[model samples]
Every structure is written in C-alpha cells, then in structure tokens.
Target: MALFKTSNPALGTKTFQDAAARYGGAIDVANRMTLNGTVNRTGILLICAFATAAYTWRAFMQTHDPADVSGLLMLGVFGGFITAMVTIFKQSWAPITAPIYALLEGLFLGGISALLELRYPGIAIQAVGLTFGTLLTMLVLYSSGLIKVTNKLRIGIIAATGGIALFYLMEIILGFFHINFVSINGSGVIGIAFSLFVCAIAALNLVLDFDFIEQGVNAGAPKFMEWYGAFGIMVTLVWLYLEILRLLSKMRSRN
Candidate 1:
C-alpha cells in the first residue's frame, strides 16, 4: 500500500506499514484484526475515559474550586502525552497504554471542562454534543461515500493540522515572555472565525482517521492493531472535542 499523510500523530504516513511489520506477513486466524473488534475497543476506551472524566467532573462540581482539580488537570495533560508517545513507539503495548491514555485524558478533559462550565454554565455539554455529533456525521459521510479521503484531501488536512499545531506551539512558547496570539485567541470576530476553522480541521481529521483505520482492517493487520486503531481514533476525538470547547468558549465570551 502507498503511504498517506494525516495530521494525527497516531495515524501517521506509515502507521499501518509499521504495524504490519510488527507481525509477519502471514495472518493469524485466531487474532487477525477486524473492524468490529476495533470498534469494540474504541467503545471500551471511551467508557474508560468517560468514567474517569465523570469522577473529576463530580469532584470539581462539589468543590467548585479550580485549585481542587488542578492536580487532575496537570496529571491528565502530562501523563496522556507520555502515554501517547509510548504507545506510538511501541504499538504492541497499545492494549495497556491506550486505556491509560484515555483515563488520563478524561481527567484532563473533566478538569478543564469544569473550569469552562464554571464560567459558561452549559458549555461542556454543548461541546460534547457537538463533538460527538461531528463524529457521527463524518462517519456517515465516510461510509456513504460522501466524504472520500482522497490523497489530496488528506494532504490538505494534514497541512492544516500541522499549521494549527505550530500556531499553538508558538503561542505556548511566547506565553513565558508575556506574549501570545491575542488576536487569534481572543473573543473577537477574527478569533471566533479562527476557532471555527480549527474546529472544522479537527473534525475532518476524523474522516482521515476512519479511512486509515479501515485500510488497516482490509490489510489484515495483527489483532493488537485493533487497540492501536482505537487509540488513533480516540486521539482525533480528543482533539476535536478540545477544539469545539475552545470555539464554544470564544463564542460565549462574545455574549
């Protein structure tokens, strides 16, 4: 199979190629990867994420203190990053690390969502609805052949994602100098437009992820690839949710 590009670090150009090499070309009948298995694994990861997320959310709701949830937020942020790196380098360990990633990310999401909800009230639920709504819409389009993942489209999405990531990185780096991309991150029209654009890019990355995961299934990758595929999908979902949350925050701040 030819290489393809995606903004998702988990579903990079050679993700399946590397996975294929992990096990020999011969397929294992007992443990061959299937689309259904991948979907099931994804559901499990999502459940794990939401379970931890709910715990953090309840804690914040009860305490009503950002300080109380700061530790969970930090743990989720840093811990998820480390776990993602580990899973990427060692795909076979995805079964172990992917769920951990989901749990840590859930903690992060819960804490951040609690903060946003504290100010914006119903924003977290709105973001969650939009995020999942986008996911289902994309899945239908992908399955119905409405949103074809052409090489050119994939390249465009990957470029846009990389640009967004670089933009965020620059802002983070400049934050230490008491400088940031205020215009883009602010609640102004331009900021809102930027967030909308970013949210769209993040959502479209789902199409890319779906296509890539299906390709893996067709290639008869190993059973463990199910976990890797699920992990990749989860990463995109997390990104989409965060972007939606940011966009909603910007919109709400305007009013």
Candidate 2:
C-alpha cells in the first residue's frame, strides 16, 4: 500500500500517450509552466488557508469553557479530518467537497487550539511555531534536491500511515471500553519514542506532497488541477500540524 504519489490516470502507458497526443496534452507529459497551469491554483490554497484560519478563530472565540471547548473541538477536529479523507476517496466530489473539508477542519483546529491554550498556557503558539519551522525546513531540503520522492518511498509512507491509522482506530475502540493499552502519545519511553518516529514519518509525507506538485506541473496537468494540487498540499500540512500539536502536548505532559 503505497501512499499514492501521482494520480496518473495514464498508469504510465500508451493510452496516456495517445490521450496526451489527441488532447494536445491535457496532462502535460513534459514539465513546463503555462500561464493557466497548476501554479495558478496556488490562490485556492491561500483561500482555503484563510477560510480555515478564520473559522478556527471564530470557534475558539465563541467558547467560554476551556475543557468543554477542548472536548468538542477534538470531536470536530477528528470528524472533519476523517471526513476529508473519505470525501477525497469519493474522487468525483473532491473539488466541491474538499473546500468544505478545509472549512470544517479550520473550525475544528481553531477550537482545539483555544482549548489547549486555555489549559496549557502557551502550547498553541509553540506548536504553531514548531510546525512552521518543520515545514520550512522540509521545503528547503526539498528545493535543494537533497531528498528525492521515489515511488518506493511513497508506497512506504502510505503503508506506514495506514498502520498508524489502524493503531489509532484500535486505540479509539479500546478507549470506549475503558481499556488503556496505548497512551495518548503512547506509554512510557517506548510510547514517546514511537511518537517521535511517527512524527518523522508525517514530516516526510510533506516532502512527498512537494514532489507531487512539481510532478504535476512538469506533466502539465490542467489549470484546475492547481486547486486540487493546493488542496492536496493543505491536507498534508494540516495532518502535519495536528501531529506536531499532539507530540508537543505529550511532551508537555511528561514535563
């Protein structure tokens, strides 16, 4: 189960070649930027970001009780996040539904941040700063070509992510039964170590997202794809941010 790096409908074949030929390259096989290419879709990414941030702020501001807000925020956050993935899996509705995903996720995050801040004081800001730093660092490494996004790597990421998701699902089930085998971050040194490892995997996924965008542009995917592309990037970023937040919270608890 690879992480699915490229959405090449062509599957690397002659059909893709014929389609590219007949359609004058609806999916640009060559890497070149057109005025209306995927690069343009970046605006959609910004739009999504603004929408998310605004809603999140609204959710936070509306909350009067810290613990109550945190609990609801967590529910909404997980709901929105899980919903986005399910929506994307539907494929046909990705464009329309993905934006809604962004909006909901924003509200979820904003409320969660407010809750965390109320309880932990400055954890929210610290997490944001740390998340940004990791993102920037990953970007620099990617732009310099120090890290390559190979098909194998993508597959590995997808597989690991699936494993992690499975563990999380189990944790959720056990939590309901009042059975606590796994810590929120994992238990003891091993749990903490596993959290760090998972965090690294999440960070590496960012690298894959960057590669996918570059590949899409080079292939000359449709201009509309830019929005799709940006949306994809946002998905990865949001995931990364949440994981970072969780990791930080666990560390704080330890201290």
Best by lDDT: 1
**Which residue pairs of candidate 2 clash?**
2-155, 28-219, 31-218
- Per-residue lDDT for 69-111 in model 2, tens only? 5654565577666766665454334457666666666666777
lDDT by residue for model 1 over 1-255, one digit each (tens)? 112356888877677766776673776766778899999999999999999999999999998988888999999999999999899888889999999999999999998998899999999999999999999999999999999988899889888888888888888999999997888989998999999999899889899888888888776778998999999999999989998999999989989
List candidate 2 segments past 4 Å from native: 1-47, 50-63, 66-95, 182-187
TM-score of candidate 1 to 2 decimals = 0.96
Candidate 2, residue 114: lDDT: 66
Say what the RMSD of model 2 is. Answer: 4.9
How far is each candidate from the true structure, as Cα RMSD in Å? 2.3, 4.9
Candidate 1, residue 180: the lDDT equals 78
Instruction: Estimate every model's Cα lDDT from 0 to 1.
Output: 0.89, 0.62
